[model samples]
Structures are given as structure tokens and as C-alpha cells.
Target: MSANGGDSKVAVLVDCDNATPEILEFALRVVPQFGRVVLRRGYGNHTTLANRWQEALVRLAFTPCLQYQYAAGKNTSDIALALDAMEALFDERADTFCLVTSDSDFAYLCRKLRERGATVHIVGEAKSPDALRNASDQFFEWVPPTVKATSEQIPALIQKAEGSKKDDAKAVAKHRPLFVVEAVKLLAAETVEGKVQLGPLGTYLRRTYPSFSPKIYGHSGLMAMLNTYDRLTVEQVVKGSWLVSLSEASGK
Candidate 1:
């Protein structure tokens, strides 16, 4: 997350034709890693398909954009999704984007967004096209559907684990903790032009490094851990979310 404490603004666009409704539920669980889903829109010809998604879509507050197929073999849903994505980008409504689909058509859209300096996350099934996966800043494959944990569970787990240390103090004492430094380096390497969303950095850091929790180091959150280091700088964008950057002088 950004050194400054704020949320990143994100737009979530769902391609219903190529994505399952259950995937939407899975994808939403991890979206907070980027920012808030300030704008949510989905495109598909709902008439041809019958599923529980119709009710779920409204319950989830998704703005469904109807795209009826023009002919027997034509695919209009992809076109609709592309148009909406371009409109969102041109309007500057979101700083990051989440594309929830497995179709390769969105591979071009992902590249276009990153070219324009927007972070893109792709969430789809494991068999998602490689081109789309490559275009995303990070990609996640959906697992079997499960009930989501309550918000309180995360903090409670952190609190309970504070007293435990997997490594001995002597082992840790020989080296200064470099979680923040390593996280920044990893993000820079993965991002274009040494920039990445603060949200994805946190996800990557946790997944790649063991014993890298901010709470374990006496900090309540990722931003707090980043603040402890002078080499990192954080900025607050529009929605009180943070964007983190490495200071040029620090040479990190």
C-alpha cells in the first residue's frame, strides 16, 4: 500500500459471457488489495443465459450494460466491454482496473491500460488465456467457491499471532528486516517504469515472503510498516487510499 494512508480507486468490469457468476464472488474478495471498486459494470446478453446472477448482480450493485448479440455467430459482449473500458479510462474515473474474465480479447485492453500507466489486475479461471495473464500486473486463478471471512477475522488473526516468532531472535538480530525494501524492489521490477499499485505490492509481498507481516513487527498495517523506512514515500490519491513510491535519493 501507499506510504500515505489512503485507498486506491478502482473500476471493476465484468465480462459475463466469458466469466461465471461464481467467479464474480471470488474476485470481489481480493479487490481491496488494489482499491475500492468505485465503479462496477458488467456486459452481456442476459436474455440468452438463465442463471441466479440476475438477482445476484443487483444485490452486488453491479450496473449491467445489456449487449444483445446481433447475429447467430457474432459476439457483441466483448465489444461492449471494450467500449466501456475505454470510456472509463478516458473519463479518469479510476486509477486501477480489474478485468474479470477469461477471454483473450481483453488481452489487448490490458496492454492498452498499462501503456497508459494504469495498473491492471486479471481474475479468471486457471485456464484463462496466457496473453491476458501476461498483460495483467498480476493474475489470480479462482478456487472453489467458499464463504468469505468477516472483516474482523483478519485483524483478530494478526493480534493473536503477535507473540509467536517463527525465527529465533538471534537469527533475526543478525540482519535488519527488509520486508519493506524487498517489497518495493519486487514491485518495481514487476511494474512498468518502476511504478506499481500499492495494493498489489502488499499481496505479492505476503505471498512471496514468509514472516513479513506488519503486525508481527509491531505495526497494525502495511502502510505503518512502510512508514518506518525513510526510503519509501506514500501519497494519498482521490479516495483516501495510498500510492507508494521509492525515493530516488535512497537508490532503492
Candidate 2:
């Protein structure tokens, strides 16, 4: 913990088998959402694959953990990832852990981290295993292939809600009153089995909705505004940061 009582160090463990290269890129871009991804590693059976990811791994500067098949039905990658996570924990090199994979095998690892007071954030496909999602302090679902960005600008949505134009009728009808709805939609879409990282959600909102200034809405920042919305749920994960979701609001 820092002087501010914040967990700023992070370790990102990627299961190359269960995660897409594109989602990995998107996930890394949002690392600052929680803190810094100080230790980055990718675990897979790289020796045999000889695929695109092998070359991609070198370019991305990820420490590769090459696992060999021990038996016909065994996957050593999951065990390797878990071992590394524990090593990072014991070494005291990270205060928070980011697990990027859809494997439920990591559920135990996430629970273990939380037990030791380390913040765990999970990122995976929309249909990721539920046990893994529930184990993390926060989790994010990778965007689905079906979700496409609309042509309408975010500013237009805000303006239509605040303006008195009849043309605003369609925009108003099509959009939610607050940016939180868009935020929630994004969360819902990316949530792997209904899990989303509050930290990354906040980061994504800021990047995608820059004009959503909390000052304009008479709040200090985005988190405050999110808390005020009855449609949103916020959980304090580690001091200043929160795990946000719409499940509570939707009564799921």
C-alpha cells in the first residue's frame, strides 16, 4: 500500500489458451484503470503451437511461460498460471492481480488472493466461467463480436438530453438520460458471465465518453455520479477504487 493507502502495483497473468489476442490488447490498454500492470506474463504451450501468438508475444514484451503437454487430457497452462500468481503474491511484488482468461480453474487462485487481502480483477470473454468471475474482487467481460459502435457521438446524446430541440426527440428516445446507462451497457456487454471490473469500467467510460464531465452534472467525478444513480451499484474493492455493476439494480 502507498501513503494514500492505495494498491498501485499490479501483476497481469494471461492464459493464452482461453483469451483472444485482441482482447488482451484492449485489456492492457486499460491497465491504468486499476493501477499499473507491473508484471506481465503469458502462459501457454508455445513450444508446439508455433503460431502467430509466439511472434506476437515477443513484440508485446510479455514473459512467456511455455508449458508442455504432460498427458493426453491434461492442461499444464492453468497450473503454471496459478503457480506464478502465488509466486508473485509471496514475493510481495504486486498489490493487485489481473487475471485475463475465461478458465474457471483460476477461480481458486482469485479467491486465495482475496483471502490474503490482494485485489483481483478478471477479464475474459462474455461467456466466461461464472466461478472465476465470482472469485475476483472485480471482473470485466471482453466485448462480444455482436456489439458494434453507433455512429452517433456521445456529445450528441448529452446535448439532446440537456437541450430543448424537437430534433432531440429521437436522440432522447433512443438514449438514456445519463452516461451511466451507456456505462452500464458497456459493462453488461463486456462482463464475462455478469462480471466486470469497476476500475476498468470507469476507465472505459472516460476514454469512450470524454464529454461526460462530472462537473457539468454537479458532481466531483465519475465515481460520485455513478454512486448517485439508482441504476448503478458500487463496491469498494480497495480504498478509493470501486467495483461497479448493474446486476444489483437489475436484481439479477
Candidate 3:
């Protein structure tokens, strides 16, 4: 259970052959916003990817399920991952699932999981099939985190610090609470019948936009964050469940 009283538990499954390490890191960061990640597994040909993924897998504490490619062109890991996901779903280990893959083959799997009342989130690349991305409750495009500009990229930063102080403040000031509120308001188009469930909306915003942070805006959780926005309204239709609708944000 989270401090915010989140009851949902998430199972994170990664198809290592289909996504990069940076994306996997980003996925893990976003999953916590939805719920606790009870199980973490990465499927791939570990023997072949040892040099590239060993340190990362170990550092992230992800259990690597090795699936070797016996043939010239075959995705043995995909089958393994699908099987495990089905078993976990049937076992009711978690109500939320995150598939970190760009493979279209899992699109049908996403539909089946949703039919069983599980919220499926896909962390995929921009090139991932639209069907696969749309099949899930939420889709997140992986973006490599930006680092500080290097001396080679901006030589002037190292040479002159006097005038750069104002520029740095300007950059930092752009990430105000209003920016997140505006984003939430814009997402009204994505809602169903003009309503957005808090759980899924939180998952969508956090996964879709990695830079979004409730803490930065001085909120404890997604509901708390949305509570501050007058343009949105939140209601508890049932115990421990929330629904948000576009109020003045919709501009109706």
C-alpha cells in the first residue's frame, strides 16, 4: 500500500529485444505513480545481451528470463513473456500491467487483458504499431532523458556565467503548476464521454510525459494535484475511486 492509499498493484513485463535500456528505466519510473510494482521481469536472449544488459539488469534488480533464439529469425522471448503475463493475469497477482515492448504482436494480448478488467499500459517507441499503442489503457513513448549541456555543445556557458544566471532562471520558471494544469485541460479530448478516471489519467500523464511531477508542483498525489486546478472537478463515485471531468477547462 502506498502513502496515498493506492490499492492497485502492478506487474511490469519487459520485452528486452523490442525496447532500449533508457526506455525501460523510464517505464519503471512511471509505474510507481500508478501503484506498487509487485513483480519485475525482463525477457530476452540474455546470453547474447549479457555485455549490454547485464549491468543494467542487475542494477535495476530486474529478473532476466533468458530465452535463446534457436532459429535464424525467431522471437522466443515474446512467447515466454506472453505466457507469463497470462499466468499472472489468471492468478490475479495484480490489476495493472505494464508491457515494455514495441512489438505489434502483443496488441491482441492487450485487448484480452483489458477484457478481463486489467489496466494495461504500453511503454513503446515512436515506431510501435498504432494498434498496439491504442489497445492499451495508456501508451508511453520512450524518450532519452536530457543531460546538462556539455562544453562542446555550449562553449559560451563555460566562458561566461554572468549573463547565464538569468537564462537559467527563465528555463526553470517555465515548469509551473499552470503548465501541468493546462496539459490536464488539453487532455479533455482524450477522455471518454468528457470524463477521465483518476487512475488512468494519472497513469497516462505520468507515462506519456516523463517530466510531469506532482511533487515539483507541491502536491502529494494526482488527485491532490488536480484538486488545485479550478478548471477541473473531482468526485468520488465509489469508495476509494475518483472521477475527474472537464469543468471550466472544457471551455463549454
Best by lDDT: 3
* Better-scoring candidate (TM-score), 1 or 2: 2
- Give lDDT tens digits, candidate 2, residues 24-114: 7766764666776789888888643357467666777888888999897788999989888888888889878888988888898888888
Give the backbone clash total of model 2: 4
Q: Please write out the lDDT profile of model 1 over residues 1-252, one tens digit for every residue.
A: 543214567888988888778778767876776777788887888662346457657878898878777899788988888877878878888868889988988999988888888878888775686687777876766644353322212222223343553332222232225666767776777767676567887887754542245554545568766776777777777686777777787785
Candidate 3 runs further than 4 Å off: 1-5, 146-252
**Which should have the higher lDDT, number 1 or number 2?**
1
C-alpha lDDT values of all predictions: 0.70, 0.68, 0.72
lDDT order of candidates, best first?
Answer: 3, 1, 2
lDDT of 3 by residue, 134-153 (tens): 78876766644454533112
Candidate 1 lands at a TM-score of 0.58
Instruction: Give each prediction's root-mean-square deviation over alpha carbons.
Output: 9.9, 11.2, 8.5
- TM-score of every model? 0.58, 0.59, 0.59
